[model samples]
Target: MQIVEDDIRVDELCTRREYARWLVRLNSLLERNPKHRIVPTISLSGSLAVAFDDISVDDPDFVYIQALAEAGIIPSKLSSTSLFSVTPEDGSFYFNPDRYLSRKDMINWRAQLEYAILPGTKEQMSRIRADYMDVKDISSDTSPEFFADMLTGEKSIIRKVFGQSRRFQPNKPSTKAQAAVTLTSGRMAEAVQHELLRMEAESSSRQAAAEEIKSELLVRGDIKNFWNEKLLVERNRGVEVQKLYIATLQDLDKEKNLQAQNLTENMKEKAAMDCQRHLILTLREEIEETSERLASERATYVAEQCNIQELRKAALMDQEGILDSKSILEAEVEALRILRTWVEDEAKKSQARAKVLEEVGRRWKWDNQA
Candidate 1:
């Protein structure tokens, strides 16, 4: 169990005083909770190389150092020469255990804590074994798996402390303030991780909601298109109906025109038939009159022919009578001629006789005179 020391300035330099307080608190917690005895043990040197004359078991700083080493946070190989080494020329070597912890040391310690907290699975052990091989200058007696458990796991506590790179400059010391901050950061990593997970869950929910909304919109659009198509079909039907209505009207008009034409033709035919009837009646009457006239003329011609025959007979009778009269007149003329001839003959005879008498009388007178 890691101790969360109250009154410790986690953002300031971690002084020896703060380390002592933290250690004391850790011991108290361990005493109170016997079940938290799972803290890993660290290998410590059997003896210190430099003999510090002033150092004793009751020394708070020395005790705190020992406590950290036991908890595997600090290595037992902490160089004590700097704390207890005497100057070559002077005997005035002051004891100052208030040295601030280093950033590197704190990171190392944090890595240890993280490794201890990891579950000891077979895969974890194998991975740690592999990881430890990559670490330079590993101790000869250190088990790779055990060393891995004291170093780091997948969640590198070192990275959270140092930012970005997890390079452990093991020898590089840390400021007391930086060490305090590193410790506090390790404790806070869990909360931050949980918050990130929560945010991701919210984002996923939002994405799901957006997809649902898009599907709904698509459905609505399809419905709208369906309605529009129906409307278009209805509109086309109306246009077709109008076309049919107009065609019906035009057909009716054509029928009416045809009927009127038929009526006019019938009337013309009736008029023609009436005129023909009148002409036939007139011709019939004329033919009757002509037939009657021909009959009358035939009768007149027959009578005239009879009269002409009678006239011809009368002329023949006249001619015969005239011929008879001429014959009678010629007979009379012949008779007259004969009578004149007789008369002339008688007259000539008488004149001859008288002459003879006159001749004889002259003779007689001559005789008397003689």
Candidate 2:
């Protein structure tokens, strides 16, 4: 069946009247062609199908007609703007023409078709069969009678076939406001899930860093303590040497004085006294050497102590810095953990709300239709 030239150009935007006219024309055409055996089928690939009840002036219904044309169920051609299909040997239908189009456009159209067919119930199916039987015997398939019968039959049959295929679940029937709420809630839950995962990762990283810092600080402290102890031992050794030298000098002076007094009575004793003086001078030299050595040793000990103290101070400062850093990191980790918890809670609430909204929408739709 050929579409009349006048009916060829449907309005770019679909209106209720325009839709009715297109349906009528299409039904007439199908009825005249026995090979086509076209029957109206619900589809959800047009703008009108997506937003059926709330369709704006710009929305168009995306529909498919079931036909035995070429031994397969295929969509009917409506206009140049209507989407076309790609034939696959696997017998699966595809909207290949719309592959390049925006997803929103595709989804809206598909939804519109779904909404249109959802209203048809079982009672409408019986009427469609009766109508088809009335026109089954017409020999001249192109007659006005054939066209009328096809339109009536096809419309009834298409309208009566309700429910979606198991594969294509309809959006929950709800007010636009309710649908919006459900979408927002779902998104919020998804965002929260992502945030929680991020927080968990961050917390783990912070703990690892803190442990590394603490270990480094402990090593530094141990080295500082070792150096400080070494300095103290060296300083004590210097003090002991100084005391021993002083006691030896005092003993040598007493022995020299006693020898001088005894030798004062004779010339030989005088020579002996001179020798004793030389010995006393040698003892003084020894004492001076010992004092100088002790002073040098004491200076070395002080330098060592100074160096050790400086090292200790630096190590302590580093330890303090590490401790501070650890504290800050711990606090940040805690904050993130808290935030993660809050996000998870919010996600749960949002998910629950979305479920409730969807259930309510389904109930309301059923009641309204009833």
Candidate 3:
């Protein structure tokens, strides 16, 4: 008997590791015996390890065994005796391998045996042993094949074998098409539901993406419109400045024509009386006025031009500012869209998780009822 340490905590008695060790040992023993090949598999019931730890006993014990005779591990005839019987003295069952072996001349024939240990104190082991031995003879060969033909059988080992075989084994996945069909039928509803959920999630993601694109387009259009409006205002101001400049040049031209007419008329009236002096004086006055007017008009035009230049520069700055704003807005919109999408995705994931949890709960309930 190899002792394996217990690791998993259940009750105070046994651990998962100890249980695993015993299972391994039992499986190995069953595999060695051809006679016991009728036995399908072995399984342990209840908290065997926990029970063992609670026991203060020092002796060995047999707890329970479920023998599967259909697997050809245990002999069909001897399967009934497979049900465990406890011994009170040592809390162990005694096996007389020689009685079962017909050929006494055979040497070193080992009986393949496997047992589980149950918990009990040293003092309790003796009492349990006595109780077990008093009930029935577990070692008795109840098979009729080796007995007289006229003898009536008192007990059927086959029935006991079947009864003890009512243990659980993990079901293996089916490879055959028929078994696969059966599994598909059983899980069809869940598979359909899962696929539907996946499609719905994909659709929602697409819808969110479309909405984000729309939002970006709207913001870009607004920024573009604002920038264009500012450009239009600056263009209109430039037109006004050009019109004012043209009007000033037309007024200066009219003043020059009026002064030229006045000088020619004065020179004709002073003929032969030294009219040259009068004509020169008139021309000088006219020239002085024209110069003064030209100077004033130039000053006004320069001031207007400076103002227009400043306005143009301001418009340019405004255009740049609008562009900057547009860029910032674009970035912000993109970020908002991304964040919104992420939030929606997270929400969907959470919903999916909840749905899965609900489905698991329903399945668990159905299995329990079954």
Instruction: Tell me the whole-model lDDT of each prediction, alpha carbons only.
Output: 0.58, 0.45, 0.43
Model 3 over residues 93-204: C-alpha lDDT tens digits? Answer: 3222112221100100111221112354333433432211122422333222212111112222211111233321212111122221221221232544565687799899
Candidate 1 is scored at a TM of 0.29
At residue 341, candidate 2 shows an lDDT of 99
Give per-candidate clash totals.
7, 13, 27
Reference-based lDDT, residue 141, model 1:
28
Return the candidate ranking by TM-score, descending: 1, 3, 2
User: How much does each candidate deviate from the true structure in C-alpha RMSD?
Assistant: 46.2, 57.6, 57.2
lDDT of 1 by residue, 61-127 (tens): 5555555544434333332334223333443222335666544444544444443344665455545
Best by lDDT: 1
Write down the lDDT that model 2 would get.
0.45
The TM-score measured for candidate 2 stands at: 0.24
lDDT of 3 at 22: 40
